[model samples]
Target chain A: MSLAFTRRALLKTAAAGAAAAALSRRTAAQASGRVVVVGGGFGGATCARELKRKGLAVTLVEANAVYTACPFSNAVLAGLRPIETQQFNLDAVEKEGIAIIRQRAVRADPQARRVVLEDGSSQDYDRLVLSPGIDIRFDALPGYDEAAAGTMPHAWKAGEQTILLRRQLEAMDDGGTFVMVAPANPFRCPPGPYERASLIAHYFKTHKPRSKLLILDAKDSFSKQRLFQAAWQELYPGMIEWVSLSSGGKVIEVDAKTRTLVTDFGRHTGDVVNVIPPQRAGQIAQAGGAADRTGWCPIDPVTFESRLQPNVHVIGDASIAGGMPKSAFSANAQGKVCAAAVASLLRGEAPAEPKLINTCYSLVAPDYGISVAGVYNPRNGVLTDVEGAGGTSPVSAPPSFRAQEAVYAEAWFQTIAREVYG
Target chain B: MARLASVLTMGGMMSVAVVVMVKTMPAAAQGVAPPGATSCSGCHGPGVSDAAVPPLHGRPSEEIVAAMQEYRNGRRPATVMDRVAKGFTDEETRAIASWLSQQP
Candidate 1:
């Protein structure tokens, strides 16, 4: 047969096969097959919504009934926005014929294609999407745990703890110390702890001029460090202090009860302690053996299928998609791509692996903002960085650029929220 | 020979479809390439010089790939490029970059 005939025949056969698989659902609801998505954050939410739109039966299991986003949680910590701004009900997702389960996923039986819930309930699926977000490693840091969080609020999850940390800031006396401990790299939102520190400084400048903010960082340098340092010097000098990992800035232990954080250099007492501990894949992903020693799941970039198991896809922060940072935008993009691949798989077609996009925005101050964005692609089982794809905040940008950045920050938040929750 | 011409035409059309799909789909679906490497020329044109977009002629492959990646994300801030770069795999990025870099 001619090559033309061969190509046409292949396309026809593939299309027919896909159609048959899609239409061969066991039940009326399962005609497109069952897709159980663990976690209702950016990645899971986007996948669930898109898969549902594609005529798939989606079941989204989340630990919290209402998702309090970590995206805008910084505003809550800085007292600029309320916690309600970040709180979202899963009503929209549920309305899309998705079975929203409000319970923690305990373990996943990859071999059996089933997930076990904290309530001892077991659910089955033909394909599963896991985007369970991040889990804090309390044990990684001595004297830091659930008990420590009571006094030293991580505020990383961004809900009640954000408010608690904010309240602690409010009650501090003028000239009181606000200590922030930032974790090393490969943590959720590389720019988060720095952004939090910047926002707090803004608050101090306006509300408590005499107050001081000290950052105890685990890393030697930070994302957008030049911009952050420059802004801090220009806007809030003497009001903020940053100690690097080499400069005795590392936190060795914390006495949460006394609000004292001990470092190699010395011990310091804080009126408010904001500790963002080291993070890993959410407990469910780790427990399922989807995660590796690095505390994240390894997946085939083409299909987002877990490296450890067949027929299971891990997306978002849980998946070690190299070169793609763990951000809401990255997770959202991965979620959609993975959903398409999953849908294609059920239809007995190969998933089309696509490029991924990520952009992270930080509020350097109320009117000033900075960001980094990149496009990533998978090569040889690793996501290689697409060089020259994105750049850091422009050096010495004009006020108008900064002002526009502030507006874009708001718009970007709304855009991602719509993409995930709308 | 008629069959060969028909096959080539179909390949061209599929390349266009892939470009349209990559450019128009949301940022997540950008990097996926159609079955063969020939589809690249459909949008890029037979080398950068012939394409509607800027010719990739003689540019460093790494630089070209970097530029595409930037365009796909909001960082570089190019409207058409962002659409074009979506859903690309790393291997595909390198392949396209190498192809454009090698074009006369």
Candidate 2:
């Protein structure tokens, strides 16, 4: 109901581009209005920071003071890197003159254009950006409630569960079997499950050479499947086995207490069971009525404005961006596009034609990396992958090529992190 | 004025200035960031990044255009640039490069 304006709300932020100057001139008083952003991940942070950079009143709402990034949290699972390396703060964002709200957004009222926080206060916005990332559908998956997640950690959201899964693997016997249930498609990070399995297998090959990784996948195919399978054979030979959907890889139920997973055809019990359950848009996105029947937000490809809700732009894993995998890279690109679009719309103009690019790098081993790249063009509000551009890494590339990809993977993470967090 | 312009363009950059037809360019692409320039920061790294990929900021527009053209025509080898280069036309590439050439 009330506008959540902090002391810095009226601060003269630096770096207002010429475009913003023209936009403010065109729209007059309304151009520099409030743009409240929810969820402070790659997508939200970039969008909020960009909006502020354009001289708009911006507020970033995040539940956590420190963000634990999911991009390279896999390395932390292997003990190759510490969790601290994956953690980042919003100090850089705050310095840019955007107000940061350290409270969970419990609800969003689209009619009022108000975002109500858990503490009962709300922020009204001229344009609202929702980037709440993904929320696991604990109810959709049988026997996999929020409580069950404590026993059989999914490690999908990173941070606490990542450490849990890794700690469990460390405590298991050397010959112990580790079963990981991969979720279905349209989920965040298509190559994540395979990458986690590979990294965990890498840890095993060194500390527990006799250990095995059994991946129960919901789909028959995945992003860069051939590259991942090839790397698995070359590096962790006979240490990993994959069961696809038709082979009864879909888990019907999970018993966290027994560390067991039940599929339609068989039951699998492991020393450590990791169930990556089905996922949908975060609760706040659904609460805001941004999501549709698909349980994901359908957005205009150019503007990222929710098709279901007016004036609310959804990005990151929450929105169903066509041809773009739900990746941090895609989110960052979309966020930038959306910021420009929002700024233009505030001045009552159609957004410019947007060109979005996404490159997702996955580490098959610490030294072996693979990627899937795509460039998308939005035509008639639908995004199509540009012809003759962007595809998977060379499946048959030499070890040297794989090693170079691994180095680039680390660099990509660092580059994207700086672009968003700073 | 000569010193400032020289420092800003870095020599090769000014050559493209006349070729760039800013009047004919799309209004949205006129400023610091071009049509797809912001997308580059997602991977190429932002300012002063030691992040493996070469920073495109402050590079000469002509050099950037040449590299992109080479990548597009398969004359250059790259992990991802080859694929990305094909997405942009020579005009759009020049527009993006010109913006990067002026970055501080």
Candidate 3:
């Protein structure tokens, strides 16, 4: 594509006139209220920025100075892209007039409408948004804890763990086996494990042809199973193996010392073991009483307001967002809707009915991609997919379509990054 | 300084030109977006110049309304739009078209 049609070009045009106009109008009508957001990932950052743009007093609290995105971390693992490319700074968001507090939020006091930071400071808000992503339930899997993570990296959080796993792959012998234990459903990035398997297989194809990848999945099936299976068969036949739960694929425990995985059927040893454990709402959500037995926060689908805590909202992976997956794009979409709703509520007006959209793209290979899209609205207090609204890429599509989707996937990442961070 | 002055002058003229142009078209409700229209902006709004996803701003209202009606009725072959169009009522579609048409 031409540079003139890139995401940056479009952003310049949109921001120069349309967005400024919208902001001025919003400022004229909306009442200013303090909105505090915890976590500076896709959802929290977007919420903070959007609220600020709409003339709200906004503050964002984050533990990290930079965010390494999870969306394309699989590419980093496959050696297709460097991990540095996935890291983003907060310059753009800070420039937008949202206060950035580089501190860990330890607790939320809903009654007081404030978030307590690790430094003993508290930021109060008329409205609070929690987008703390997910916390790995290390106890869910025996023998898999922080210590074990050093040897068998989950690499799901997309930072140091990603580098560790990549190094493990590099050190493995040509004929060695790499075992991956996929997490159960409701985890972040439903199609991620399969995509990682495909990319790793691609890596082995080019670098270590004799190497084999074994995917021990906890779920019976996964997102884009057929598409992934088709790509595996066509691209890296016999190099990758996938075992489902019914076939004794669920990993019950691990012996990190021996680098062995224990499943219901048998124990298998590998040169490298990557275990993605079960997940729950980030600790702050649970501590704040926003999450329930399911380990996810329940919310009003219309405004993403926490059902348990008044005036507090949850978005991103930590929330039970009906049918939406815990992807970066979904978080960004929910952030915008929540911002609009909060802006209206601050003005003492009823929140506008919201419509949510999501599109997740997974690359099977460098030039081959697949996607799923959906449009959703609140129905019976839960977000439900609009009938016949969105679907996945056609299985019978030509190679060119997949190639185009790969390009579109990159464009989407660029556009969403600019939208949320810049 | 001269270039900055020329750019500011052009920007002022552009804003004036837009006002005059919008005044010529039949005036619609100013601020409110249609109930379901904001969702479309996620993909089709400003800063998205993808050929596959057309920008919705500055389009003729009648043309947009006609296209949405066709999508809703299954006359348009769409990957996703047909289903999304069905979510909006005809009046809602017209409202969206009217609002988007007025955008710069």
Candidate 4:
């Protein structure tokens, strides 16, 4: 079918289907129950939106009135995109019949089936879904604490810190050294550090051509390492240097005043330091008693129900989802799956088996991108990667192909944002 | 005696087959969406139309199934679909195609 014709037909069909669903939902609304969602990022927001769409009453408790996405925050840091582009209001979510509470969730009482807010008020729920993303572990690195973060911005959460990092880069003189300390594995966004390095390099290449970037990585290998390295060599040769853990790249301590990084083997001084510390489940997860010794909540891969708490499920970065890295796309997918499970549980039905998929794209430059895609299935109580299903972008792809991937990457961000927030 | 024994065995097998069919028909009718299909909505579902990625909804089941098989088999050129199509088994692909075919 012609593309235009197909789009028109699909729109008509969607409108008809929506009308039918709305009519049925109105009749079924009498039996629907309340679903309380904590955190308002990709996973929580998507879950809340999906539940509300299904005629269920949903309450979304988020500390921030506006959510700034982390997916493309690197672009903001590099001055390629404005921070405002990453920020979203809750108006779209509110229009979907979700009760938006702009207050911090202090605790989750599973036994009481209620969540306490910072204001001392508690909201009762028939079911609770937690999508609180992650918390920085200050103790992971000695001398690297919350206070240190102001001087050495991580900018991982995307907001004021992002602006700080951008301003620091802009202020640095030509030929100055920029240093980045990457986090360990099982953290949010495995390829994030490398992408940040690439974008920062891009900035320096354009404005401060004589500047240098040093990356101190915790892990020896990273997601799409070969692709990133190749792009760096081709795009900004001699401008970026990556030090692996085996080569004393792991930063064990930091001095914010001196702008120094201490590793097991040696110490390095730089003009600008970006320290991304280790991470754990968001504090509310720990407060709720959902997190375990590992500092992440264990979940049933099929239903995302917390092994620690009944009727309270955790998704996104806080949940130990097997074989699924913590990415916005993964969280978005998990959100939909969890929403379906929560809906089924509310109706006193068995949750269906879930198949999950994730595709993460990283931009090395404004016009160069690469991606990895995977499909997963719940097997033996854990999500396992389906063999022969997903793969990374071809290593030998031409520049034109890479540029096209970048376009798709931006489109994906736009589409996902609409899906989750709207 | 031989003829009588053969007839009894055939009758028993036929009755079991009928019972199995009766048990499975309802599940087939109430078709649950297979895993991984919902994720497609992020890019290929509603509110996304870039011409690079085609819409999967409202397509014929046979057409959808054929396209996926081609992508999986490397018979079709793709930017990312080939990698994505490999993630599903033929049966899973069929299930996804059937689900999408029924969608508006």
Which numbered prediction scores highest in TM-score against the true structure?
2
Residue range A35-98, candidate 3, lDDT tens digits: 8898899899988887887778777777676699998899999999998888887778877866
Candidate 4 lDDT over B3-67, as tens digits, reads 32453354344434434444444333424567777888776644233333445654557877887
As a whole number from 0 to 100, the lDDT of residue B40 in candidate 2 is 85
| Model 1 interface CAPRI class | incorrect
| Model 2 steric clash pairs | none
DockQ of 1: 0.04
Number of clashes in every candidate structure? 18, 0, 0, 4
Instruction: Please give, for residues A1-422, the per-residue lDDT of candidate 1 as tens digits.
Output: 36785565455434433443343354345444788899998889988997887778777887565689998688787889888879776778876767776667899998898899876867778898899889889898899999889889998887778888989998988888899999988888888888888899888888888999899999899887988888889888887889999999999898888888899889988888898889898998888888889998999997899998788899988888888888887788788778878988999997775666676778878778777766666788887666655556677876756655665576567656755676
Report every candidate's CA lDDT: 0.74, 0.83, 0.80, 0.83
What DockQ do you compute for every candidate structure? 0.04, 0.34, 0.15, 0.24
Better of 1 and 3 by TM-score: 3
Reported per model, the fraction of native interface contacts reproduced equals 0.00, 0.72, 0.22, 0.62
Which of the two, 2 or 4, has more TM-score?
Answer: 2
| Candidate 4 local lDDT, residue A163 | 92
Error of 2 at A197 (Å): 0.8
TM-score order of candidates, best first?
Answer: 2, 4, 3, 1
Give the TM-score of chain A, superposed on the true chain A, for all candidates in the order listed.
Answer: 0.91, 0.92, 0.92, 0.92
The TM-scores of all predictions, comma-separated, are: 0.77, 0.89, 0.85, 0.87
Q: Which residue pairs in model 3 clash with each other?
A: none
Query: Per DockQ, what order, best first?
Result: 2, 4, 3, 1
